[model samples]
Target: MDKNIVFLLNFKINKASSSRKRGSRLIQNLDSRLRGNDKRVKVKKRKKFVLLSLVFNYILFVIYRLSYAAKYLIN
Candidate 1:
């Protein structure tokens, strides 16, 4: 009877350990996926900022060219 009890206890311990390992692996996978998504969001924001800056610069250049043209015409 004592031997049977020991075997059952050992089996329970192994089962618990295996479950813990699986849970940790699941957490690690979720963390990596979240990090990947965050990086993509950051990249998208950076691209949007660059595009807006280019548009603003182009508008400023056009305005400067228009002012120069008006000045030449007045002369």
Candidate 2:
């Protein structure tokens, strides 16, 4: 199981001369950006999951065939 975890960090650096209060506007902007990033991550996760499952199924199939052959040889 390969998990690709993405960490999004938003840093706000304020200047000494700038105003102290940014109000709700800044919060709204950050919220929208975070939501967009979340959607992107979800899509990537879905793709990875599909690929992982395919590989797992292939490995299981190979093992099944090998065991079947071994049993046949023993008989």
Candidate 3:
């Protein structure tokens, strides 16, 4: 392990915790940017879920149409 890196990280962690009130969150006190990123990540996940549902529904519809066409042809 690099001594310099460990020292720098420790210094930062100590500095952040020292500045905040007792019993408050330590890491989150550093910045609100992380909170915003969490929201963006959640929204992206929601969009991906919506897209997957749409594709699944479309596939089911296609199968249904094919089955209906085959039944009519048989008759």
Candidate 4:
């Protein structure tokens, strides 16, 4: 009877350990996915910022060129 009890306890312990390992693996996978998504969002935002700045700079350059031409024509 004692031997049977010991065997049952060992089995239970092994099953519990395996379940914990599986849970940890699931958590790690979710964390990695979230990190990847965050990186993508940051990259997209940076690209958008760069494009907007480029467009703003181009507009400023055109305005400056137009003013210069107007001054030359008036003179």
User: In terms of TM-score, which candidate is strongest?
Assistant: 4
lDDT values of the candidates? 0.73, 0.63, 0.69, 0.73
lDDT per residue for candidate 3 within 6-72, as digits (tens), equals 5755666787675566324444432333345565578899999999999999999999999999999
Q: What are the runs in model 1 whose C-alpha is more than 4 Å off? A: 1-29, 32-37
> What residue runs in model 4 are displaced by over 4 Å at the alpha carbon?
1-29, 32-37
| Full candidate order by TM-score, most accurate first | 4, 1, 3, 2
* Model 1 Cα shift for residue 8 (angstroms): 34
> For candidate 3, what is the lDDT?
0.69
- Cα lDDT of model 2 by residue, 1-75, tens digit: 112212222233232125436634445555666567655678899999999999999999999999999999999
lDDT of 4 at 14: 62
Residues 1-75 of candidate 4: C-alpha lDDT, one tens digit per residue: 368755755565565566887656555554555456655677899999999999999999999999999999999
Residue 34 of model 3 has an lDDT of 36
Query: In model 3, which regions exceed 4 Å deviation?
Result: 1-37
| TM-score, model 1 to reference | 0.54
Window of ten residues with lowest summed lDDT in model 1:
26-35
Give the Å shift of residue 17 in candidate 3: 17
RMSD of each: 13.6, 10.5, 6.7, 13.6
Better of 3 and 4 by TM-score: 4
lDDT by residue (tens digit), candidate 1, 1-75:
368755755565565566887656555554555456655677899999999999999999999999999999999
